[model samples]
Target: MELQIGKYTARISVLPPIHPKFRITPEPAAPNSTDGEEEQIEAEPISGFTCIIGYTSGGGEVSERLITCRSLRAHGTGLTIGAICHAAKGFRAFRVDRISAVSDPHTGEVIGDGSYFSRFAVKSSDKARAPSGGWGLTPSRMRTLVAGLNVLSFIARCDGYWHALEDEPLANFIERLWMRKDWEGQPPVAAILDHAKRLAPDSSIFFASLETIFGSRSSTRLLISSVRELIEADGIIQDQETNWVLAMQQHQEEYYARKGLLGSI
Candidate 1:
């Protein structure tokens, strides 16, 4: 068959499934309104491997099986090595007519397989850093980084600063934090601070401190609300000061228990 690509008309050919004697041609061009430019296409031919070409079924009608850049763990080619369109089944299908060019890397042989779908190596460059949930930096370091973030830096990252950390007072406080030295090389600090300021431009030191530990003032408010609810439900007699005293006593008891020291609850 002959098909036209751009301004150039090239011959296209396919081998018979029975006694395959393939004689390929450049696909001829058809009239197009876009622009006039000759399309360059070529294919590579491998010596030992079997190669064949044919038409592709137009889109969705074909099977989902594709020779993706994945594993070769499958035994033999479920669908022969080189096939076209729906026939590509599990075969490595390369577009012969659309191929720009082909060249053998090892021998530098200018083969005719570039247009044909051939297998190649694939690689990834993404780094898998440690996961960041469940726990965070120690309280002191967290505070230091939060204090070191600001609005300009936040705006630079161009993420939703306002929605992530909603507190005007806290935002303002974090903007001032950008001057601290401990946040060097810390992109998260800048991103979080920028997000906070965008959310709450007028935020303050106290709210900033709260946000550093609990994420946002709203979260801290929710925590305080839950604690108040617990206090009301339990009918606690102790105030904040007394609660602190009791908490300290509980810590002392835990410390003693860890050291083989026993006491009542």
Candidate 2:
């Protein structure tokens, strides 16, 4: 299937189910809730593992089984799904940590999911693959780099000046981020920021994709480090950059809290 990604049309290929990455092994049964909650009748699990997915919509855990990301799959570190959202609608990427629960859609029976990400403490940079030049926008692997840039764009505008920065590192970052094959070849920095700000009002895709990118510990660290370097590069933090930097830091704190890691400012 082909999906319109930014200015380009990407042929999205769904990965095969038996590709070793989508296999689901039996998990230890979840302990019964001793508090005497009502039990639900178990329905036959779907082969695709389709179920009621309760996720943090940032408001709270929304148990929306009807909403699934396209090309859903789970690997060693993260889970990807066909996020049936109103934003882009086809598929929005998601980080599993933001997900609170998964349940049998038919009976509303809760199912405890995997814990692959927590097995490691500090993540190594090489744990996950780096972004490619946006070739096949296969429904499986959504663009992580563009998503990261979306986050930076949001931060840049948090101070109410949603425009391009004259700062060196930030400009360089924007320059590199826009060079992805799916985007128009590095348009004027000012125009890029303008477009992003315009997209801000209804850009749910921005938040979803940004959270998805942060699923990888390495990606989170890389983004945080870049924000630090970008804001400090000029050696003069303006009120604008200060707000942006603080937003980025707040996200970092939230990420730490979710991962159960020892967080530091």
Candidate 3:
């Protein structure tokens, strides 16, 4: 299946299911709730996993969406998915039956209708043992991670144009931190990229705010190395990229100096 939205196109191939018999049972309604009202059955939250779906709205308009699924629940004969739509930049409820296709955003692999919900149930159960709802990182650590990624993204776009090759280094950096291939409970890469693209135009203010989030030397070094790889990915070194890196280093040094500590990078 080929999904085209404006200039972007993706080829999705359907993959066989690993758990064919998996199913999600809707949780019972609240004690005071009345009939006909939708009950939200909370399952283990699935973060990081994103899917692109060809959807036909109730009004009959057809479109493609990139969604980061947050929750799923049984609704009548089908299922309702609660997700953050990348294009819409907000949470939405999508009916499974209205969806024509569900594809992986990174690999473009189509997930069968039954297999899509099944995989969610299986992953939710598998990750039930983990204390952290997603990514296994604490709230503070996750914020720092996002801030670090934002810093790297700013450096990647320092040259004015964001090269396609830059995404490879960013993806590699995330994979190194979390060793997972299924895309479940991973970082939202698309959202990050979109945010980076928007903020790249005015980086001084954005970068300055992100700089305060990192207070450790190890993380600072990792971010610097990652930025270097991103800038070099396109094979053309720009003076703007080099200058931003130096500025980041200098800022960190000044920050640590104010705290009476050596901030050698």
Candidate 4:
């Protein structure tokens, strides 16, 4: 996690813990006594904070509610939560097992875990897809274009990986991109693309014409090659007959907007 939360940068670390004990059914010949059934069995002691592996809704957990879980945010009870993993709407993260002993800062009471998702990086302006005019690809098409193109990245020594933001959709990518205003101070689209390609070596950037951008290119062959590769396994490529210039402008504007660059469009 490269994001900064409050004063701390996001970090992942291993937390040492003990294995939990599972109850084995007693044999029928044993004298049955209900008195010992509710006894609590202690597990191994765990170290510091770490993500506890367990099933929750859509890979996350509900908030303010406990469901007799075997794990507790990978931490022992009585510790205040530092953060949560895969939880929908709870504190950054919390330990359910600690609920019995711990109290919420606001409520000052022990409460069941329930969903209370808060804190996200981006916001959406509209859910609908933009119209297809000029270079404007539908949200679906934009998604395809963004998904197929592998942006270049350096991962130190071992043949760097392109940071294409794979886990997020195009809209989300736009949200993050727009949030950073990365393209604001750049010289030109062509210059950036050229630098990215030259530096990364394995990168590929695609677009239709040189006229759309202010850069000078001796040939459109490279652009054509990149486009061909982008569309190779997908299927046939459809060309828009409308004014390519105007369409591309609209496409650029919409792309910027999707990314959250609210000014230009």
- Candidate 1 regions with alpha-carbon error over 4 angstroms: 1-137, 147-180, 198-265
Write candidate 2's Cα lDDT for 1-105 as tens digits. Answer: 222233211211111112222223322333541212111111111111233344565567444433322233454666544343322233344456676665443
Give the runs in model 3 whose Cα sits over 4 Å from its true position: 1-137, 179-201, 209-213
Q: Which lDDT tens digits does candidate 3 get at residues 19-83? A: 22222222343464332212222212232235667888999987777665545667786677776
- 1-55 in candidate 4: lDDT tens per residue? 1222222112211112212331122223224422231122111011111222222
Cα RMSD, model 4: 21.5
| Worst 10-residue lDDT window, candidate 1 | 38-47
Residues 157-257, candidate 1, lDDT per residue (tens digit)?
12221222233334333333333323334334444532223221111222222233243333333333332332333243234323422432344354456
| Model 1 residue 83 lDDT score | 26
For model 4, the superposed segments whose C-alpha errors exceed 4 Å read 1-137, 151-158, 161-265
- Structural similarity to truth (TM-score) of each candidate: 0.16, 0.35, 0.44, 0.16
Residue 193's lDDT within candidate 4 is 32
lDDT for residue 125 in candidate 3, whole number 0-100: 42
Per-residue error for 117 in candidate 2, Å, reads 33
**Global lDDT of each model?**
0.28, 0.40, 0.53, 0.25
Best candidate, TM-score-wise?
3
Q: Indicate whether candidate 2 or candidate 4 has the larger TM-score.
A: 2
Ordered from best to worst lDDT, the candidate numbers read 3, 2, 1, 4
